[model samples]
Target: MSKMIFVNLPVTDLGASTRFYEALGATRNPHFSNENAACMMLTDTIGVMILTHDYYRNFTQRPIADAKATSQMLLAVTVGERAEVDRVLEAASAKGGRADPNPAQDHGSMFSRSVEDPDGHVWEIFWMDPAAVPGDSSTVDA
Candidate 1:
């Protein structure tokens, strides 16, 4: 079986968060969804679990930090080409998200940009060329 990555984020409204993610091209996963939480699939191997504040507290003993004021974590999605980065960022913005207040890195090898969700969770969309990647001689082209 293949391994999967599940990212759990705290949200005030599970349905609203689900709608936001759905607008960004993610689909809901019924296998792990409920009234208090929604599982959103980013890819076959990556998924995000949007949990309501009340439900999220049940998973962790630590305090849930206010994402708007201070980010608890940042999620990054990588694409195969630079154009994809812009496409994703644009889609995110169209869905009520905002562009991250940072410059994009165009190092001729790798490119990256970020966006902030309504809840202030940062999502960085990037593209890296394996052939042009630095310090990675172990990688080979087909």
Candidate 2:
């Protein structure tokens, strides 16, 4: 079987979070969804599980960091072209997300931008010209 990834996030408003993800082109999967959690499918292999704060707490003992005020992990997604990255940021912004929370990155071959969801979870959208990568590629790590 192929590997799949499901990034679980704690959300204050399940409805708003679900809608925000829809704006980014994800569809809710009813099979894994309920009143306290919504499973949004970004792709066949990538999914996002947005759970209510109460429900999320059931899985973790640590305090939930206020994503708006504190730094946590950053999530990223790659698109096929540079224009797609811009389109995603615009969509996210239109759906109450903060566009470009971080500085944009343009390395000729790789272009990236960031957006923060209403809960302050940062999502980086990027595109890269695969051919521009060196044969060794390890030298380009950043």
Name the weakest run of 10 consecutive residues (lDDT summed) in model 1. 133-142
Give a tens-digit lDDT track for model 2, residues 1-142. 7699999999999988988898877899999999999999999999999999999999999999999999879999888899999998999889878999899999999999998988999999999887888697446666
RMSD of 1: 3.5
Writing each residue's lDDT as its tens digit, candidate 1 over 1-142 gives 9899999988987776787787666799898899999999999989989899999999999998887788656778877788988888888887767886457778787788987777778888888777765676566466
Instruction: Report the number of the highest-lDDT candidate.
Output: 2
TM-scores, all models, native as reference? 0.84, 0.91
lDDT at 36 for candidate 1? Answer: 92
| Global lDDT of model 2 | 0.92
> Over 4 Å off in model 2, which ranges?
134-142
Looking at candidate 2, what is the lDDT of residue 5?
98
Each model's total of backbone clashes: 0, 0
Record all residue pairs in model 2 with backbone atoms less than 3 Å apart, i.e. clashing: none
